[model samples]
Target chain A: MIIECRNLKKTYVADGQAVTAVDDVNLSIAAGDFAIILGHSGSGKTTLLSMIGGLTTPDSGEVLVNGIENWHQSDARLTEMRNQTIGFIFQFASLIPTLTALENILLPLSFGNRKAASSRQARDILAQVGLKDRENAFPAQLSGGQQRRIAIARAFINQPAIILADEPTGDLDEDTEQEILAVFHEYHRQGTTFVVVTHNVHLADSQESPRILHMRKGVLSEENPARTRAA
Target chain B: MQILARQINVLDYALSSLWRRRMKNLSVLLVFTAVIFLVASFQMTTGALTRTAERVLENAPQITLQRMSAGRQVDIPPEYAARLSSIYGISRIVPRVWGYYFDEVTGANLTVMGLATDRMPMGDQLHLALASGSFPGPGSRGSVVLGRAVNDMVQARGSHLLSLFRNDLSMASFEISGVFADATDILTRDLVVMNIDDARDLFRIRGDRATDLCVYVTNPNEINTIARKIADLLPDTRVVTRPQILKTYRVVFGWRSGFGSICLLTALTAFIILAWDKASGLSQEEKREIAILKVLGWQTADILAVRFWESLLVSGISFLVGVTLAFIHVAFFDAALFRPIMVGWSVIFPPFHLVPEMTAQVVLLIFCLSVLPYLAATVIPAWHTASVPADSALSGA
Candidate 1:
């Protein structure tokens, strides 16, 4: 398994109330599996994806990536996992406003202990995302669709084993959404695991014979009848 | 080495970030520079004044004797000079009569130095040089040599003669014989040099009484011993040594300097408070920026380095600009604004050029007092913001 979660739970205190975000969720994803987690607002979709990506630790469970328990590891080791093994695509405008599009794409490699330089990789990824002409443009200068393309390109910069995307198509038109899905399909063909969390039912239906799961009120359960794989 | 190279890239990013907000940062920079300029100018002026005082005292007498009767200074008798001349280490004893003469027109006290022409050095051997006219000769009745400032004052009053008033309501008029050159203006800015007979007659000194005695020691090594003997022998008088004079100057300058520092420190404390408030209250956009970086796999240390570079760039530039402006103001323009406050009695001000004496130690002190507080102001807030996890940091925004 490329990623595994056992009895994952997370509770947040909002206004002096303990609101359970993720409850006893167990999940296992193999390499090259493109999975979609379907949920509405306030459902545990983002929280579950964040746990598997090593961004947020579960309150009472273990998140293992390539056999290394991420939650119990030191902060440095967890950061190493996030840098080398996992990538994230947030829903909002997350590009650093001060940096150019190319610089934003190159930001991940600038942080991690990556001995090798990434100038060539940065160029190639910009070309792949069809943003070669807009590399020097700041995020504020770009269209919403263009910025999302750059965010997708940044997530692919480190070539991590898994990519966790939360509502990647939240701000795109139908055509731009299709274009982004096509780009993801192209990378999915290259055996990168993708765990996408979104509320768009069309996106969930578009996946051909996919391992689709439903999350509502902090509980996650499989929905695809054809895929009955157990954790 | 790789991390260092990557940090350089982060520094580049930080530079761009600062430039993006240059207008806002410019205000902070200006205030920071003002704080530095104030502190540096105060320090430089005091240093120059202290050094100038020491140099001025170099030409002063080895030992001075003043009569103190009933806790008030009285004129010493001329006979005391002959008594002090018999001391073992005393080579020469010069009895000098000088007193403050109030100029009613100018409303400033002018120092009237009585010169015994026959015993005084002449021409280039004399410390005070005549700019144009010659010094008043011994037989030149009712004539006085004036300093440049005094000459300008008397000329401004449309009079070529100086009207000096005495405490006993007696007035004397002296013809302006000559003016001293500007080179001696520092010590003689308000001086009026005249013959002893004219000074005695103008000030109503009867029967050969002098203001004080200037003792010249034969050997430099025996100066302290001679001073001790004079103190013991002249129990009714006060003996002031050169070292004692220097010490008094040090105390005066130190007290004024400490007071100035306290004022600057208060302003500095206010600046630190402003900086701390600005830094600690990170905008929502800035918080989101940090969050995005963490999501992009940036470590806590990397975020901190970015903040550190930002603070350092602002403070470092401010320090350089402020100190440079202060140097130009003090060494070139003579610290015109601060001179009035630091130096009281503005009419008798020293007119010498200040030689800036900036050492590495001074630079380090400036750095600590100016730069370090700013860094602390920003860094503590940065550490607090960076301590939050990326997931929650975004949620707050």
Candidate 2:
């Protein structure tokens, strides 16, 4: 298993009241699985994904990513895990606005151990995303699709075993969404596991798209997920 | 790499984000600029006042002497002035030629403290540069070296001729010659210098009788002991040292030190409030930006370092602008406004022309006490808000 979570729970305090954001959630994603968690606004899809990404810790429960006990690790170690073993694609592209496309992709690489953060790995990764021509473009200069594409490139830039995408297609139109999904499919074929969160019912309905899955309002359901081929 | 990496690099990020909202940044910077200007002006004025006080305490008046009687007025015959030179510490004594002459042209009335020395160390301190007229040469008669301001005034009076009164009745005329500046005493510019014989003749003081004795001690500190001993030896007369003669000034500078404190305190309080406002008013979006930076693998130290850089940059700009503008403000503007604020006319010429001291230490201290506080003020807040719960922090934006 590239990603695993067991009995995850989160309670948020607001105005002196405790509200459960994620309650007793358990999930697992293996290599070669491309799954999407479907939910509406406030359905806790983002919260669940945030916990698996180690950006937040659950009030009670354990999460392991590639045999590493993530919840038990120090913040430094957890950050290292996120940087090297797991990739996070937030709902918004959230590409560092100040950095160029190439620099943003290479940002995660710089955070972990120094091997791929070096010049050689950065060059090869940017080339892999077919973004060599657009390396120097800032996010504002790029189209929404292009920015999302750069974000997709960043997710795989460090060669993380699992990519946790929280609505990677949220800001895109249908045609651009297809292009972004195509990029995710190409990386998934290379044996990368994906746990994507989205509210798009069409994406959830496509049995050909998601493999192992769960819905925040519903429950986990294993289906014949679409298998994509690398070009 | 450490030197180049930046003290607070995230400050650059903060500023860039602030820049996207440039109008807000400009308002903040404008208020900041006004505060810096006020601080620099105050500090420099205080420094100038301190220096002027130092200058006034340094030199003795040219023709210093004691009164023959303990009473305020001395009525001695002129003939005894030349013979008084036989006394120890008496380089020479000349008669008091005149009681006091009021020069209407210069607006001063001072008793002529007659001199017999050819050249004097007391005169050198007053010089804008050295002067080369006769040094009261061997019974030199009817010659005078004018103090810088008096010389200019006398020269300005036109027709080098000057009128002096004797016995408060007879008139004496003299020529204006050389002028001196860089004075050790402010009173030096107001006194008139004349030769021993001419003074004796003018005052009609004769023989071993002079109003008072003027002493030049080889060792300056021995003046007090020498004055006491001479007072014991010459029970009829008294000895006075130049330093002791000029004792009314110590209280003025005593007032200056207190004024400097007020200036520094005002500046310090203003600085702290400005910092508190800037640090406290940071919005949620700003916090989210910092949190994102933290989550993006920036260490807590790294995030803090960035704010430090931003603060430093702001301070550096303030110092440069503040000091430069202050220099111009003092140089062109009258320091009267500051004098009332720093020490308030306590008999010191409040400095209007200030040459800025831009040494590394001054710059560093300025930054440390003033700018560094503003810059470093943001650290704990930035760090605490940065290492926040991700969801709440993000939602703040």
Candidate 3:
């Protein structure tokens, strides 16, 4: 298994009321799986993703990434995992404005936690994303699709084993969306595990997508056979 | 050396970055520069004055005779001179008569602080060749020597080093034949030197009493013995060391030391303000940058080195520039930043003679005592900035 979550729980006290975000959930993901975590607004899908990314901690139980417990590892080791093992493609607006396309792509590698070989890999990722000549242009100068491509380049800079993206194609036109999905399909073909959270129902129901889990009101539910729209 | 090289490289980058924001840093640098320069000048001036005192004291007469009367020094009885002349190891008993004489002709108040003796005409404080003309030889009596500064003041009245026969009431003309320079008094910069008898005749104490006896000891080591013996022999008189005699000029030296203190205090206050401004004016973005650097494996000491170099570069540049500018101000313009009392009194200090010692030790002290405390003071805020988490730092900026 690539990721193992055993009885993971996250709770928040908001307005003096105890709210369970991820309640005693257990899940496992294998390598080479392109999974979609489907959820409505306020369903804690992003929160679950954050815990899985080691950006935050679960209240109890274990998040073991290749048998290394995220809860027990030092913050430095956790950051290393984030830097080396997991790549996050944030929403459309997450690109840094002051950074050029190449600099933005190299941001994760610039953290002093990666090898020089990873910098070469970052350049390769930029070229693969079709931003070879646009490296010097800043985000404001780039089109939204191009900016997302540079962000994708940044995400894969360390050649992480898993890529987690939140709404990677939410703001793109149909053509640009298909181009981005093609890049995802290409990475999935290369056996990199992928998890995407999106409101695209068609994407959630794709036949090739693996193990799509739907969430509502901070709780995950198994889709019924009667509800066959989901893949 | 490599670490220092890298530090200098970083300093160069930081300096260039600061240069991009010149207007802000320039004002701070100017204020800092002015304060440091003024402080340095004040230190140099005080140092010069103390050295001046030391030089004069070091070269002054080792022995002096003073008469005590009602808590003020009075004239030693002239009869005591002959008696003092007979004291053992006393090579000379130079009876001196000096009093303020406002010359009616020159309209100048001449301070006759020291007098020419009977055999040795110019007293311990003088050399006759330094006079404009000539001093009388060993046998000359009733001939007086006049300092060029004094002769110029009095319009060259006397015809000899000592004049026993004629008396001129207006300029104290008493046969002053020679002219001298170098040794001087405040009131007698334009001086009239004369034989002790001529001064005695002018003061109308022909055989009664003279002021102080300028004694030259045969054995300097016997000064205490001689001074004690003289004090006992002339029970009515008191004795003082040469520096003590020089201390009478303390009104001048006191004013000097006091002025130096005030200027330095002003400079120090300005230094405090400069340090305060440097500390308080660092922006949140700059602090965040430091925080990020710290998170990226920069050691605490490396960050401190950055601050140290930053301050040193600012102060060091300002120091060089300020000192250069002040040297021009003093050297070319004949100006003391804070005018010396002699400076303001129309005595032209010799050109190119501002012998200020800017020693490495002093430079180190200026950095260690003044600028280092300031750099260390910055540690609290810089450390506070460095201690901030990278996430908050990145997010805030």
Question: Per-residue lDDT of B1-397 in model 3, one digit per residue for the tens?
Answer: 6555556645754575456457876876787667666656655554444444455355344666778878887767667678887688887766667676665555555545335543442343345234354544334545556544555544565333322222444334345566554332222345555555556667666556777777777787887788888888877777776655556545564576567657666766666665666576676656665544432334455566666666667666777776665555534443365654434444322222334545676566555545665566555556655555443322334
Which is the leading candidate under DockQ? 1
> Compared with the true structure, what per-residue lDDT tens digits does model 1 show for residues B159-215?
989877666777788898887664455566788988877777777887488787878
lDDT of 2 at B176: 48
Better of 2 and 3 by DockQ: 2
lDDT of 3 at A136: 80
Best by lDDT: 1
Which residue runs does candidate 1 get wrong by more than 4 Å?
A112-124, A130-132, A204-209, A224-231, B67-82, B85-185, B188-212, B216-232, B235-238, B350-352, B359-361, B393-396
Error of 2 at B357 (Å): 7.2
Question: Candidate 3 docking: what grade?
Answer: incorrect
lDDT of each: 0.80, 0.60, 0.62
Share of real interface contacts recovered by each model? 0.48, 0.16, 0.00
RMSD of 1: 5.8
Worst 10 contiguous positions by lDDT, candidate 3 chain B: B345-354
The digit string of per-residue lDDT tens for model 2 on B255-300 reads 5535655676576667667677767677655666565555455556
